[model samples]
Target: MSGFDPRPLLGKALDQMGELITTTDDSQRDLPTPCADYTVSQLIDHIQAVVRRIGAVLSGQPFWSVPQSIESTDWPADWAEGRAATDAVLADDAILTREVQVPWGQSDGAAAAASYIGELAVHAWDLAAATGRSERLDPELAAAALPAYRAKVPAEPRGGDIPFGPVVEIGDDAGPYEKVVAWTGRDPQFAA
Candidate 1:
């Protein structure tokens, strides 16, 4: 495929997540999500960390060099800042040609950005499910991310250190968001 510009899709996914975050109540922080190990709060924290790390990669910094942590309070504000920084970095076309270190190893910037786009989109759905908010994640963005996810993520076990579980089965007719989350091993029907 031609070079994929993930910035627009990333922006839409982040915006959808921002809407979902506002609907989250403090009472629901401990609620379970599709990711069996993570509570809603923990998942949100992870999303913020991923956003920051990806921003670092886009900025020509070593992605792992930045320490990742979630602020217990003011997480929404933290997410907004991270999103803005990531957006700014992605806006530069030069980033697409650069190489970045990601968890899977060194990859070109386009691949790295596409990976995060898939991650954020699926996690946004997880957060929405956990929080009992609307399940209407951006289908367009999900569809945009599906190819990269399918190409990179195998059907076999990804390993213990990998956060993703084995791919879950879903019907071929499933919607884009459902297909994306299922590819990440999340049951689309799961709720807190």
Candidate 2:
């Protein structure tokens, strides 16, 4: 409503993740990621599902109406389809102020976009770490999203429906991206 736009930032982050997903080696599919119990292939499926579901939300569909998991042998095409759906709905700035219902609460387009930016940025890091592509990540995604995450999700009383663990501690050398993921309960030092 105040002319704030996080779409470009979200788009850039999503694009980075798309590149990471597309470039992941097939052999790495069974490898473990920083996300507990999620293999590279399973994480990729989760990213795809998140994309499709969020796109459905922006397109005014019920949140739970979309499938929870969408497997993909061709990640590039799957990513493109989700992006295309979101791009179509987000093309108009008018939607920025329009109200949308999310899992936690009702929010306008800009807030929804920022929230998703953080969510996907964290998942993107998971994908990168799972496939040894962490070095290719853009720090801006975490930098832009960290504050929103801190404001929205508390650091204490984790578990249950919260879906996040206690914040992990990182060293002095940790970058913004690392800190952001660490804040979300991921260990930035994880390797595939």
Candidate 3:
């Protein structure tokens, strides 16, 4: 995890998103995704929304507390456009290291960078499943994200049982990228 660059992870996510969107056909537009209630389109839009909110935080502004309404029909183009905007925000050196507060938790610029990396990595898996793509994430970023994600795991034990399934096992011989995807609940065999 020492050589980790969060910015590049975000960039990779954006790239993966573009690839998914471009490769998707209308036949798969309405496919259900791994996200509990969201279709592929809805998931894409939500991912974009998160990215936009992160950009707002990076810019030292409050994000999504207002809960603006987004139409389901607007998902595709809007999501791509929003990601482009977020990419621009991340590209700015000032925001790269700037301190800001996010709704989830207070974090410095480095934290913000890491947060996006984790988010995009997870969401990329979701998109990959819905679109039938074999996608993997950066191992170092996933390792860095594990503690953070574990910390945020819900304390409210629903029905005295955690709302999760057994952990997916990656072979010692497996690549970090594969482990990252498996850890994030994505089947690496999904074909796009």
TM-score of every candidate relative to the true structure:
0.89, 0.94, 0.71
Candidate 3 lDDT over residue span 50-137, tens digit each: 7677667777777654243244455567667777777778877777557678656566666777777667666666777677674443
Best by TM-score: 2
The C-alpha stretches of model 2 lying farther than 4 A from their native spots are none
45 Cα displacement, candidate 2 (Å): 0.7
How well does candidate 2 score on lDDT at residue 144?
88
- Lowest lDDT sum, 10 consecutive residues, model 1, at 65-74
For residues 64-141, could you state the per-residue lDDT of candidate 1 as single tens digits? 766655654766787788878877888898888788788778888877777777877888888887877635677887
Note the Cα lDDT for every prediction shown.
0.78, 0.83, 0.62
lDDT of 2 by residue, 33-133 (tens): 89895898998888888877766676666667777668888888888998788778778776678777788878887888778888888988998888777
Candidate 2 lDDT score at position 180: 92
**TM-score-sorted candidate list, best first:** 2, 1, 3
Comparing 1 with 3 on TM-score, the higher-scoring candidate is 1
